[model samples]
Target: MHEMSLCENILQTLQQQANAQQYSKVKTIWLEIGELAGVEADALRFSFDSVMQDSIADQARLEIIDIAGQAYCSHCAKNVPIQQRYDACPECGHFPLQIVAGDQMRIKQLEVE
Candidate 1:
């Protein structure tokens, strides 16, 4: 699954941050995952443990913050919640929606020592 690769990238980022910030260990990671990012949280959690083995972030706690998908509906001129890409606007049933948020995955905070 792509979550494995995503976890690997996360490890790489953590390693880089550790070096740059001079932190020896990571205790926790707060991750913001948007619903529209297409990432499975369970898969990511499994992959993270596997990928972080023997690394600085080994056994680190992963705190996931789920972000709701949102889009701007031109027909209704309001921002509405969405579950998937190309979803019809909930308010006006418009086909084309301008995505406003919930399409990103990022590290929000890290507890390190």
Candidate 2:
């Protein structure tokens, strides 16, 4: 799954942050994952343990925050919630929605020592 690669990226970010912030170990990672990002949470969790083995973040707790997908509909002229890409606007049933939020994954916070 792509989650494995995503975990690798996360590990790289952790390593870079550890070096920049002078932290030796990571205790926890707060990840904000958007629903529209198309990432499976269970896959990410499983991949995290494997990717973190023998690393500074080994055994670190992963705290995931699920972000709801949001978009703006020009036809309706209002913001609406969406579950997937290309979802029809709920208010107006229109295409070509302007995405406002979601569809991204990012590290929000880290607890390190």
Candidate 3:
């Protein structure tokens, strides 16, 4: 799965941050994942634990925070929760809404020791 590659990226970034800050070991990692980002949380969690073996982050705790999808409806002139893109706005029942949030996968924080 791509989560392996994702974990690799996280590890690489963690290494950089740890080295930059002169930290020897990582204790926890906070991941912010968007609901519409299309990344599977369970798969990423499993992959994170599996890929961290024998590494500095081997014993690190993984915390995933899910972000809600949001959009601004032009027709309704209001922000609303979006379940899917290109779908009608729930409140306005209108299409062509501007996506304000969601579709983002980022590292929010890293706790090291």
Candidate 4:
């Protein structure tokens, strides 16, 4: 799955951060993954160790925080929680709600040496 490549990207980012921040080792990493970000947490976890092997983050603990999807419903004139991309607004049955959040994945925190 693409989760392998995603892990690679995370490793690359960790390397870049280690260089910039002068950290020699990474003990933990906390990631914020939005529901709509299309990342499978289990798959990413499976790939993390191999991707981080021999890197500064080797054996690092990975923590994923799940973020709920949210969107603004023009018809309802309010924000609502969404599970899928095309979900209708919960209150007004509005189609195609404007996404307000939960479509991104990012590193939230790091514990480094």
Which lDDT tens digits does candidate 2 get at residues 66-113?
999999999888899999978999877999898898989999999999
**Prediction 3 global C-alpha lDDT:** 0.86
Q: Per-residue lDDT tens digits of candidate 4, residues 1-113?
A: 79999998998899999899999999999999999889999999999998888899999999999999999999888899998878999888989899988898899999999
Q: How many residue pairs clash in each candidate?
A: 0, 0, 0, 0
lDDT of 1: 0.94
Clashes by residue pair, model 2: none
Residue 84 in model 1: lDDT? 98
Is 3 or 4 the stronger prediction by lDDT?
4
- Clash pairs, candidate 1, are none
Those runs of model 4 whose alpha carbons end farther than 4 Å from true positions after fitting are: none
User: After aligning candidate 1 to the native by TM-score, how far in Å is the CA of 6 from where it should be?
Assistant: 0.3
**TM-score of decoy 4:** 0.95
Off by over 4 Å in 1: none
lDDT of each: 0.94, 0.94, 0.86, 0.93
**Model 2 — which ten-residue stretch has the worst lDDT?**
84-93
